[model samples]
Target: MNELYKVDTQDPVGEVWLLSDFQNMRTELCEGERCIYPNDLTKTLFHKDLPRFPLLVKYICANDWLSVQVHPDDELAKSLEGDPWGKNECWYFLQKGRIAAGITRQEKPLEDLRNGDLRILTPERGDLACLQAGTVHSLGPGSKVIEIQQASDMTYRIYDWGRGRELHLDKARVATKAAASAIVIEEMRKFDWKYFSIELTKKVEGSGIVITLSEVPELHVLIDDREEFSEEALLVRPGSFWSELL
Candidate 1:
């Protein structure tokens, strides 16, 4: 059986004061921490239903900026952190205005961060980035995205602007140490369809990106080969709702 999970919305920096409103607009499935799926699907599937597909999809609407964060790699997470799996994510920009992504002060050395001179990279609309675990990144304000990733909720926040709250700097620093060794600060190459059965295309608009997904029915079981279906096309608009296939 197929199940859908909604993500739990959180405000780490308190910048997203209206998270409740934005949470209603977008949908997400953050496993272990804030999963909306009411079943033990995350645990049962990979074990009992080996042949069944276990993919989690989400529509993220960032009303306010998120903290600068990074996820741990599988080996490092498993060996050092004792996590069974790690995170690998891809982002499709739906609406983009004053957006920033990627690592900016990668080669700047730890001294830059100590001296408070670390620079961060921001992304624009029509940009697609594949986040390999351990990549330090964050999204700027006025951005919406369709995020597809491994079903794990192991995010390590590095920095959050001081907004009348204190962050867990000790834990965050530990996570940063594990991830700092692998941070890459370059333009991420677009996802290639040759690697996966699906293809995504994007067109630039005023402050948004019109995204299109192309797939061959033979390659995807959920997508029908007979006729064109609107449900098959997942469309995400900024400050709006997210659509998914059941």
Candidate 2:
């Protein structure tokens, strides 16, 4: 995707944050002919007490297996990491491939199942995999996806496939659940998720990604002709969003 999009980077580009509003990393939001950073639009776009944007969008391109990880829910997030939000993400596959999601057998120890002891699911292009918080998952090699999730990035890495990275087994053990739910594959269209809702469409031409807020008068659109991803998302307001595919 980096080569296809002509993005120049010194290191391998694993993830591209399309829309974000964290304190350290922020994406510009365009309203009409004006463009402003999301952090600066809090007065008009967010409530006075809200900390950050409600949703996050990213383009993930993996050539190898990603870390097997899990995320905490709202209660766990606040108690463990002092974060206001937890990550409950969905992946919209751009390329047909496989993914390691959920444990294959319920009785096996999670530590013993760290090395690829998970169910392998094959999802074709345009299929969406909804992964709620605490669901253990890993993206397979040669898979590209558009990820939509809560604004937080609280990931607890259970395994790194012998990368020697620090493991969070203790926290992961507490956050892990035997059978929260299985990943569901469905066609991408409109999704009314717990944290946020998304509506997808295809565009022949015009802007790169346009986000229209349903309740607010303001419209935030991301315009970048250089971006050539198969699909990209636009975050409207909290609990509402719009996505487009080129």
Candidate 3:
């Protein structure tokens, strides 16, 4: 792990929050003698009515299969959880691995998927998988990935591989969408989604304006692309930012 996120662990660490504003577990930033958390920083960088930071970025190291889970969309999130954002996430793989994404067919029952039958996708290093809300998915073993998503942490787990962890099958059934699935992208340098944009590059040639809901936006950059990726992040006012080689 990078010293920025280093931790003492007896068991394998599943995930690291690189930039998150989730309560209690939020990441912090320091400027000279001042230190602030992302949630508090949002109040100054965004509208006063803004509930929280709009993005969550993480580094996940999956030693075992993750829960077969689904997330609610913005509409469902508002009605079900009374939250402002829904999770629409993407994974940039740093290690070759497999993942289960959506149902194999429209007729495949969600119950059958709970028993471990799923459509598997093998993604190579440098591949990106964009997963919109309601996509039933699971990360397979040995996947080292960078995940960027909407700020919400609402996950409805469908299955847990007999780990005996609580399964949110009822909520997951409501959240699962037959049409939702992972869109695996390869050789793509840039991604512009509804909430944010991401670029994977060794070089950035020019200046760019980051268009987002917030007038001022924060950019999370993953530096030194290796096993344990490092981070270089900055907050830009009026949503403008510069680009250069990492």
Candidate 4:
């Protein structure tokens, strides 16, 4: 059975963490915190049954901007880096504002990222974006939402907006290459179903992809099929399940 786990908040950014123990999501709250996977149950289940958990869900908050980052795929992570986990994530904006996301340069060669001339894109509220494994991306100031994908925490930071702090340049460069190697941005298409599905609109600027979807309670269930059941939803408030629904 699927279960909802509350996310613990962490520092640097404010966010609530929700994870299933089966997924072993460590960072309960706060943004930029790493979610650990291969939870005890997933580990045991994999050993016993071989195939069990398929995906991981995360709640992210970005009061301030996050480090520019990317993630590796499973094969690259395992064979090249020897890391067991790699990231593949998609974002659904729950609450939005003047937020930033996606890579800055569209036509520039990946090598330019090394020269550090890449630009950044700032998206408005109600935007949706997909970050396939290894896509260089970051969350801008004042953004919060849910991220769903494979369970992994391997990230590569490419840039930090001259905040004047010590940065992980070495790892960021390595991760940038990994992300650049597997970059893929398909135009966002709208859902055709009229009775239930929400419409999606997308555009591409520079090298980044931007998307906008309708913001309404009716659209919530369209993001995830499991959201329909009150028991399966993540209650952000003490009685949010009953109150929000009512």
| lDDT values for all models | 0.41, 0.67, 0.67, 0.42
How many residue pairs clash in model 1? 5
Error of 4 at 229 (Å): 5.2
The list of candidate 1 runs beyond 4 A from truth reads: 1-54, 106-125, 163-198, 201-227, 231-246
RMSD of 3: 8.0
lDDT (10s digit) by residue, model 2, range 175-223: 8876764465676666666456555543423322343212111223433
> Stretches of candidate 2 above 4 Å error?
5-10, 30-33, 41-48, 202-246
Report the candidate with higher lDDT, 2 versus 4.
2
TM-score of each: 0.51, 0.77, 0.77, 0.50
Query: Which 10-residue span in candidate 4 carries the lowest summed lDDT?
Result: 237-246
Model 4, which residues run further than 4 Å from truth? 1-13, 20-54, 98-119, 122-126, 160-168, 177-246
lDDT of 1 by residue, 185-245 (tens): 2333334321121233232222211223332111111111223334333322221101111
Q: Please state the error at residue 238 of candidate 2 in Å.
A: 4.2
